[model samples]
Target: MIQTGEKELKGIIPGSWHILVKFWPQIRQRKLLIGSSLFALLLETALGLLEPWPLKFIFDGVLLSRTDIYPDILGFARGLSPMWLLSLLAVSIVAIAALRSITAYLSTYGMALAAIQVLSEVRSNLYSHIQRLSLSFHQRFKSGDLIARVTYDIERLRLVTIKTALPFLANVVTIVGMVVVMFWLNWELALISIGIFPLFAITTTNIVGKIRKETNKHRTSEGAIADTTSETIGAIRVVQALSLHDMLEENFLIQNTKSLQEGVRSLKLATFLEGLVKVLMALVLALVVWRSSLLVLQKTLTPGDVLIFVNYLKTAFDPMRQISKQIGQIAKAIASGERAIDILDYEPHVRDLPGATKAHPFYGSVSFEKVSFSYDPSRQILHEVNFDVEPGQQIALVGPSGSGKSTLASLLLRLYDPTVGGILIDGRDIRSYKLDSLRQQISVVMQDSVLFAVSIRENITYGRLGATDAEVEHAARLANAHDFIMDLPQGYDTIVGERGGTLSGGQRQRIAIARAAIRHSPIVILDEPTTGLDGASEHAVNEALNRLTRGSTTFLISHNLRAVEGCDRILYIEKGEILERGTHPELMAQAGRYAHLYRLQNDTNEIEGVKHVLEA
Candidate 1:
């Protein structure tokens, strides 16, 4: 199995640059949209540079009557009266603003759209990859954390890419354009105005690391909060029954407070950086005004030139100031991106082999030839015990909880590969078959049958996509689910609550059996199918299970020995090793552990029945 260690989780956090590199391929795929957005950005920057020129001309040529100072581009305006010049400059300002707004809209909209599309694809890919990861990987992580990574983390990346990163890019471009123009106008003052940039860089660099660290902590806390919420809500019935509301609320408050603290810390760091940038900008502005006033006194530069220099200085520094403000958001995005990238980079431990092929139709014969397995090296789940079943045979696996009964069933379904030996189907190594194809031939009805929040018909048809309505009803009938389904408010169209919570346990099990029956697979694995059901419900579910397993090779993993009495063979496992194998009668004759446990269970049931009769 692919192990995720604490050291690995804490190691080598990816920086912003690394995040960009990781997502470059997805970003590259939308080249045309990005290219157009860049074009618009450049155009907008050019327009911004022009915005100040009108004021410059109005100040020098028209207002100050220094028409002689007009550049060649505006020489033609010198011949015009002051009134006409003012009118033209006013018109030019409006025109420039209008055009700049248009290009800004185009650039922002284009980039935002592209970011949404690209990240949507990333989200989809991440979800698909999560689904394909080994069961062990999922077992190691909280479902809520995974859900947060898929949904909340990706949303953070999208929001920052559009709301923060895109505008930051445009501002950077504007700063570059303004800087060049400032230098062309007055290199000495431009150099002096930009002198504080090094400080901004230093301040940002120092604070960003702390901000990113805090943001990562905040993200983790949020994931923990998500986990708490999902767990609490998923088992709300149990929680309420046990009166754990206040305790769970207290736990949620703890996580929420931690998240709030971390988020505030990150924002504080960003605010500190922004404040430092503003202070540096003010210092630079004071120096520029003082120095340029002297130049104005010496007549080396016009007041209009001074105005342009000041304007360029502020405009150029604005992007840096904005970046300092958004640094926290950017850091949070990078942290979220790394979480997503870690999942994308993970290799599933149970994926198909290079030469694997789709399995041929199964004959339902299965063999565990000295098969041994472990989730990890230190804890072996299944010991090397051999077993074989003829086509259409029913095999029962009885064991104490955590004694590898379910692990054997999981191996048969290829949920995890054996660590030591090989499992074979129809005399061939199970690994030779593609995972989907091999799994498609075997159907499983877990102890807790999970159902989506969809209509009853949809849940039944989920067994075999595109199954006809007749087939759905027929399979439902086979599982004894059709009658109750028809009596529902919307009949088969009735929507189930999450995990089929709306239905009785027996109803859910029967629907699950219907789902398995619809597959018509040659092999079926039942893991405590009738567990936790009332006596009547158990009888109904057992009848349904009998119909579902008819004509298929079945593996039954159940605690109720009476339920497996009719199986062709019984394997009694203990501590990952099967110590007894025979029919129920044969095991009873052996008077071993199986018989002892069965007798003890029967005695307990008899006492319970007597107590119930006395109470009645």
Candidate 2:
């Protein structure tokens, strides 16, 4: 969906600002607050320039009495048109303070609104991009890490983008404004006050590079911790069953310690840079005061000029410190943007080739021709697999644990394409149909049926999303789950806890079958759907399976030959090939692998049945 070209990868880091510029279109929709932020910052800088000038008025008029002095200091200020100058200075100072507060509020509120609007869009886009990525990306990356990047890392960027950017922008404007005011006051004093600019520039340059590097690591480490915590929580059941809770806790603790170390390292660098800026301010102010004092004593400069330069020096330091603090936040935002972009750039391995047509509803006929596949190429899992099933026919696949029975189902679903051959439905290459449409015509009930955390009614509705409540209940009845479901106090409305943990294996499996049944597709697949059920439960599930697959082309994979006894045709698979094929009596007469497997199961069933009889 992203249509990423060559420059994109697993983590999308924009090499240039042009890639980032693409976000402005989405951002512009919230233009009012964004424009307000810029206007406020600019205005704040303009108002800040007036703050120091009022201090110059105070020094020249009320405090210093610039004209001349009397015998005593109090006598010096005693009467001489000082009232008019004093009154003007007082009003100006109060007015400047009020203006400064108003500008700060405007800039802060407007920028806060803009940051929230823009960052929300970024988070949503990142999530959509991750969801669109092919399974390969998910297989290789840790679930915890992706979760952290989406949740924790993105939030970090929010803090930097909204909390830091506004002040940093305003500070830049203030620095420029201070330079202008200094020049207006006295060009020579302005030059002297700013002589340390080159030194500060070099210092900021070296620190920005180092701070960016450390901040990236620090953010990544924090993401790792969040990832580990999520992974541990998701697998808490497995951890408890395996008695691995302590081991997982230890692993999480190690990651937390690493995050702590990185956080401290980042804070240490920030503190050092802040202190260096403060010391630079102090030295520059001392110089301006010393030089202006000499001029005043020589009757060339007034004391007001000296005081104004010292105040300007202080004003200038705020911008530099703001800049230093923001550099660290900028580093993390860049890292987050790059990470999200990488997933957005990936291409899925499977896609329609040129000139492919959308597949229509499949007829019952299905065939596999010379289909060979190897998820790992070093060892082929399916080799020259060939098979055909008639319309409304039932095909059984009997195999040992590692045989290619499951692989056959996967190929039919087109989860992966064959390396050397193709599968067809109604004489058309199955891949010709769009992926979703092809799967829609086939319904599968695997060995372990997955039940989402939802009500039984909702779970069954997953089969046919728009199916009516009556249809779902009817499907549940056909699957033989209606009785147990009604036995619960809440009936179909009861929530099936995570993976249907509250239900027995038979109940979950039966509900899963109901899901497939409600879809009423032309082809049905059952992969040992009743593997772990008890005898009575298995019989009920098999009865439901019969009802679900009635008149539908069906493929059944099972180790128990009894389950496949009614199949029109049976294929015995070994390793990756069909070692033998026939009906029940036909295979039994042959006395080959299928017969051997059948006899073994029959004998085991006889012994178990007799044992149960004796116990009864």
Candidate 3:
């Protein structure tokens, strides 16, 4: 189906043309394949032109005894008996038909192969670019919309070679050859046939223009449907919990209905263009036949000559008909190309600079120096945040939900660069290191531990490529996941469902820990790693965390007060600043915000304990 947008086609005429011109280099890279395809196309056209000649010989020489008509054209039929001449012409027609079929197959298949190769490369490049873009870029666009641009949009571009280029080139060659031979046989009839082309062109351009506009709308609606479906399905758990099935269905129906209406409108316009072309073709054919009959009766042209003229008339206009029919498909492809180019033309905001150096393995020392950040200038998320961590230190960050705790972790990962000032690792500005190399030194596990729908082993080893089987098991054991993994039917080979939904919340967190454990990075960030676990699962995970944190510089973010007591130091963060920084007991002695919140939680726990004892 056609997939594109109107704004995507804002400069589409020039934009699509530029994309086609840019693709010329890749197309030339497949010179041998395309050359063979072009040769086959030319051969097919030649074979098509030969098809009517045999009929002409049979009509004039064999049936009407007009042997003088094509004495030189069909030299074999000149001296043969009528029956033998007809047989010769019949054999020639069959041979031409067979060759045409072979050439048509070769041309279509060869072009399709080359188109697939070029678009495959395009898709690979586009996907890689999207992956490299900053988090802000992804935030601006939906995953489903990006997915549509990379897949369906690229597919539409591939259609250009098969639907537009192949047909246009082959048809043009056949039309030119037929027109020349038509003029040679009867110039007057040929003129009458060619005269209808201007009107056809005018009608085609007008109708196809409308079709293209409607197609843009339809394609956009389809993208909206895709985005809505992706978002809904991704949050299917919440949707089911909130009983939003009818609401989501109504929302999808609105998008789908718009798409259906636009699709019908585009189809109607295309049908009108096709019908208009058919009428034009009939008129041209009628004019050619009328003029050819006059010439035949006037003794200026033989019956066979009139037959060739009529056949040539039909053959010459066939390309125009085909092109008119293909115009809608061509427009859709152009719109898609424009959208693909939109992504290709984007400059990633967070790419490594030229001459960027590969980072040495981090010694685990990290510092945020007067760093500031804002998604918008008016409302800053992190304001002049400053902090320092010694090598192999375990620092706990405690704060309200929007108090910039996760933002700090994100900055350390360099998923974003600070708007002002800088962050340093081992006394080197993080931006000075190659992005990939810098990221390799730090491992992260967030609240929602995302896992692919792959085998449990594959998901774990994703943190450290080329990890041996034994090493994978070791990491799993360290994360308290090995026993449960062994209980599964496939042991470590069991396939996890999407986002690891097949596993329980605690199971998923343990797997995430196992994945992080295998990384063996000197720096690890656990943001609410054990937040949603049960009492037993939390205890198990906390024990695993104790083992995993040994000798590693750890940044632990959590809301559970009890979870932070074991850290070497706890930082009470509020409103983008550290309100308190000390050991758990040290903070309690100070009687600050941290002490007040801690004692309040302790009082609530004591009350719960007393109530439980009384009920027993």
Candidate 4:
């Protein structure tokens, strides 16, 4: 079994860079999208830097009575008048805004499309991997929690990619551009402007770091809330029958309260961090302004220079504060990725070996050679058992509950492999066959015959996908389900509710028999097929089953002794061992455990029949 708990959970929650690196395969597939978005981002950043330049020209050239252009280092506006330069600068601002708007849209839309594509692939892969995992792995985890990981956690990655991941990258690029330009304007003033960066970094690290930690806790709590809700709703019938409304409500509320508390704590830290960044940026502006004013008076700097320095400082600090706010989301995406990746990383314990080949047609000659099994090693469920059955024989397995009857069927279907020894068909080990081909050759009608929420025709055809309409109706007729189905308003097209809840137990069982009959496999396993049914319903289902299992190697597992009379042979099993094997009359003649149990049930039924007669 794939083990998971605190240790595995902690192993998944990797750092931000780790998340990026781990998902690189998805990222690598969208190179065109990434390249387009990056180009647009470059355009937008370049335009943004030009945004403050127009104001610089207006300040130094128009307002200060200068004839040369503000940035005369290029000497491009040597012949232009002050008014002309001001008008040209105004035009430049409008053009910059228009270009920036177009590029911003492109970058934003492209990244969003890319992120959605990558996350969709991730979700698909997670679901596929989860479906292939062994039953033991699934039994170890709650279905609700796994659902949350597939839906909720994977969704977080989508939001983080578009909302947090892309934006964070853009901000880093903008910050770098601003730093290089600030130094070019005046190395001395630029140094003074960025002196508070160390302080800003320290404050953001302290608060956002805490927020990230709290956000991780918040995400986990939300998953718990999802799990609780799923469990409660899935079993709502039982909850209502037992009046467990208040108890479930209390449990759900506790998880919701914890999630709310963690969310609030993260918000508080993020808000405080944003405020601290603003305060520090204000102080940095004051120091830059004071020093720049002295340089202007001393003829060492232009007034436009001060404006550019101050504007760049604001631009740089603004993204710092934005980063502080998104720190929580970044942490959440990383945590979600960890949970999602856990599913994808799991290796199924029951997958076929590399050289395994498809199974040939089975002749139904099965041999269990010292087969031993256990779900848990300390408590063995099936001990060194051996048995053989010929083709077209109906063998009944009669045993007390938990005597390894169902386990034997599961091993035959390869839902799990045996712990020791091997099961063989036609003297070849079953493990040598490919999993799908082996399972497809055996038809199973479980106690609770599961039907999909689809058309009656579709449900029956599931046994053999793409079966013709005539073939489907033929199978239904063989299972004695055709008459009632044809009587319904929509006939074969009638839609069944989930698990066939709209139909009676007998109706569902007959449809399941029809599904199995359509497969026309050589081997059949009927596990308490008539269980939990009234006498009339059991009689009807048994009639259907008789037609379905004719001429097939059948294993009938039942506690009802009356149901086993037609079986060709009977095996009496107890405490993980088969103690007696014979036909019904032969077992009764031997007066073994099977005979004793059968006589006791016969006496009980006689008493129940007499009581029913008196009540009637």
Candidate 5:
């Protein structure tokens, strides 16, 4: 979802007005449409106020024949017969309603269009911002929740903008116009009609805060449900193999039930407010009718004046009832808008500095100068690590799991900067170069290289976008992936499933190698690239890797000592420090940690090989 600052999260939730102010820039972009909509709204409110007056004139002048009290604006109607006057007033009512309907349509359509355009742009920008956030930030948050904020939360805001905001604005203007007219008709009756407003305001104000709180709770619960569903679906194969259905379902059901409870609680508060508004409105109506009847009997007011007063009261109070009914939805939209604002306001922890410039073509000399790093302060992952690799050299880093071998590769690529020292390329600190330019000069193939659900050609071209079809095929061939790709029905055009699930482990690794090959970067990193593959697949992937990294500065992080035996130099690291560094023969001759591990690994391999022979 939106990445809120710690301090911002602890503060009070902002009101709807504050949310609107935050989004005012986007709204201001559509000023022309908003202006036209406002004009239409004013016109529509004017017509609605005029609606009851036609009937007023008919009651007082046409039926009762009260010409003395007739409005000066309608003096011409005095000369007409009662039948003609009644006919004219009826036609005026229909005319006023038709005009009001047209204006209403114009205003509604304009606002809805503006809302859609503005929100769609906001959604796109949020998605882009999320992608650029630091990898640490992504690891800390659930992807499903982020998806919920980008899609569902923004959608909630759009719906409220169209369905609730427009009507609320129109009703506000109508209320103001009706109130002014009511006072003009009779000051005493107007006072009685509006006297209940404070009670209505107090009732709504007291309950609205609770409704908003419950809405926030409901939204949080929904996000949790989304995270659960996303995590389960992403690892469906593992869940099915492990028989985790019942356990996962139980967790999902808890979130679902909590969401329902909070949702219903918010709705119940809104409903109570609506019922309270109706009661307050009824009280005002009763007092106005009773007082107006006495005035009519005493000849202080005309029958038509009483009729107009009651009509205005009902019209004015109707908007209050509608607002009360919609409080829950409005609160939900405000919560969602706050979430979106939080993300947009967040600055990426790692971004290009003001003076950063494009990096020049690198000769692939990499140096880590006393570099120390950690994902968190509680535990350091890498400590005082010093190393250097010349251009065109192949270095192997053999370490136990979690010994920071892959983290060193990550630091070289600038995914995360070293906490205590600098990484330099071609003798220049990497931070001096723009992030995108620096990263473009290096390539990586992780143990589980991810591929999108697209054609094989498209996946490879992602390494260096705009690579031609011929270049893609050449890269595939270099990686030893061309034969199997061609055997497929669609050749290079064959679509891969998500994460390349449709392909065998060997085939996926070969495609990933091709992607790295197409980049043609001077620096390459292979992190356990053949970890889980069978012997045949491992051999094929190793062959392809050799072709791809032929002239590049390559750092190979692997557990299999056999692969490292061929590298020009090998570094045996443990506990975030390089324990030994030498050529394979030299390390073996020294009989240090590297020699001990190498002999143990080879012994295990020999035993496994003999067992395989006997079984055959």
Candidate 6:
């Protein structure tokens, strides 16, 4: 189950220690909870420390003859006569039993409550940070990977935080308290009992460190599987349409296999480490017994003292084993900490300039001053382009695919900034305005306008949240969506399926248009708005489009030259530069690239007409 690469990693003691030290702030907060938890552990450690004294007293004072033992055996049994020894023994046994019950209840609950509180805070913060990352980051990371990190990897921390880790720490303090008391009573016996610790540390570091790294790999593999599943399911339509279901399943199985292998390997290594701890405990016990017996015979130590040391030796390994068991959890926690920090530390590519303020309500005059852009630093997607939109004017951008039409629209919306130049709204550089304020001045509809899975009313009013019912209806009517929305079973209340899949393509486009219409921004950017519609549907939508475009600074991007012909001016773009710029009739009259394309379309239509005439 464990990968070979992970198994070969040498244990680095200092590095792991530094990782813990660096995260001391997180530890301190947990320690405050651990302190509350420590209160209960104090009673448990005290009960354990007190436990040995009573037994030592019983052995020396009553069973074996010793003068000094009387001071430790607080309650008297011998003074009450022959019935007294049995009564005292029974009371001593009951006292030890009662102490254990109080120890269990107080220590476990206090630690459990504290761990959960920290987990709650961590999950909330991590979730909030994910939301703050830009849209581009989300596009690059798989949905399933992000989901698994937040839910699965984070849950591993939660499991260890409450159940395994804090308890182990509390017990370490308990074990230290036990050792201090044991050495105070008899240093020679304590030293003999503790000799196996260095060996235990060696064994634990080798096995647990290897296993901890593998556990992280298993978590990563699980994320890959989840990512594949999420992607497949999200695009279920494409998968079914292309008959890729079996291929996707095979891919998922490959990732799942790796996860399963790591999980099994981690389990095996954990079991091996636990068994080694038990073996070390036995060895230490045997050593303590052999050493203590010789002291007893030489009269350096009494039989009573030898007996208490034997019990001490048996339980002394508990803390070492406790720490060894928690190493995997601590390692996983460090891994989670690294991921959460990566997100919090990353700087956003776009940040508003210092002292930036809101752009006042737009006057619909958008100007590009030698604007240029590139998604990557090495290649330019747009050349230095200059243009200006007169207030309330309609301008059209005509181009083939990859001519930077969509990128131009994106810049206007402030989805991205130009690499080499600034965009000015009215007379001000857009960068000087607050980001949200800059975006608010423009409303847009792309070729594939997205609608959420919600009611028709909700879809239309998405552009302006908190819009009144009357406003929602008005926007729908303005986009020519009111008649169809009324025709649906529930009128405005009709629930649109996911991405408005329940509606026809043209219907979905209209709903998206209505959403854009509701914004009522001064600048409207329509990017290939009616690309795939039927002739009659395009005519119907164009009627609503005409109503929406009026009185706004409308910038239209379309592959269809006819769609832009009606605009006041058209910019025929080729590559990164504008090939021509004029009103549609002027471009047609100029006999350039625009005129050539127009003639081809006219000839094709006439040819189809001639064939029909010949057939009749």
Each model's number of backbone clashes? 0, 7, 0, 0, 1, 1
Q: What is the lDDT of residue 365 in candidate 1?
A: 93
Q: On residues 1-616, what C-alpha lDDT tens digit does candidate 1 reach at each position? A: 0111222223324476677687788889999999999899899989988898899889988888998788888789979999999999999999999999999999999999998998898999999999999999999989999999999999999999889877877777777777788788788898997788877755665676667678879999999999899999899999999999999999999899999999999999888877876788789999999999998899888898888988887777767756654655666677888999999999999999999999999998999999999888999888897999999999999989999999898888888999989999999999999999998888889889999999999998889999999999999999999899999999999999999999999999999999999999999999999889998999999999998898999999999999999999999999999999999889999999999999999999999999999999
TM-scores, in order shown? 0.88, 0.78, 0.86, 0.88, 0.87, 0.79
Best by TM-score: 4
**Decreasing TM-score order of the candidates:** 4, 1, 5, 3, 6, 2
Tens-place lDDT digits, model 5, residues 1-616? 1112222223324656676687788888999998898899899999998888887788888778988766688788889998998898899999999999999999889888888988988898899999898887888879988899999999999999899877877777888888788889788888888788767755665676577678889989999999899999999999999999999999999899999999999999988977887788789989999999999899888888988888888788778656653555666677888888887887776778789999999999989899999999999999999988999999999878888998898788777888999999999999889999999988888899899999999999999999999999999999899999999989999999999999999999999999999999999999999989998999999899999899999999999888888898998999899999999999999999889998999999899999999999
Deviating ranges (above 4 Å) for candidate 4: 1-25, 65-74, 205-275
lDDT for each of the candidates? 0.88, 0.79, 0.85, 0.87, 0.87, 0.76
lDDT at position 172, candidate 1: 76
Q: What is every candidate's alpha-carbon RMSD to the true fold?
A: 5.3, 7.3, 4.6, 4.8, 4.9, 5.5
Cα lDDT, model 5, residue 402: 89
Candidate 6 segments whose C-alpha is farther than 4 A from its true place: 1-144, 209-275, 296-313, 316-319, 454-456, 483-497, 534-540, 600-616
The collision pairs in model 5 are 1-146
The segments of candidate 1 whose C-alpha lies over 4 angstroms from its true place after superposition are 1-17, 198-283
Better of 2 and 5 by lDDT: 5
- Model 5: what TM-score? 0.87
- Give the runs in model 2 whose Cα sits over 4 Å from its true position: 1-25, 28-33, 58-115, 183-278, 295-308, 352-358, 602-616
Tens digits of per-residue lDDT, candidate 3, 1-616, equal 1222233334446755788686777777888998899899999998888888888878878888986777565666677898888888899899999999999999999999999987888888889989998998999999999999998899878877687868977877888888788778777877887788777766776676678779889989999999999999899999999999998999999999999999999999888877777788889888877877887889898777777776776666658766654655665687787788788888887879888899998899999899988877888887787788999999999978888899889989988888898999999999999998988888888889999999999999998889999999999999999999999999999999999999998899899999999988899999999877888998888888888888999999998788899888898888877878999999999999988988888999999999999999
Of 1 and 6, the candidate ranking higher by lDDT: 1
Question: Which pairs clash in model 1?
Answer: none
Better of 3 and 5 by TM-score: 5
> Candidate 6: TM-score?
0.79
Q: What's the distance in Å from true for residue 277, model 5?
A: 5.5
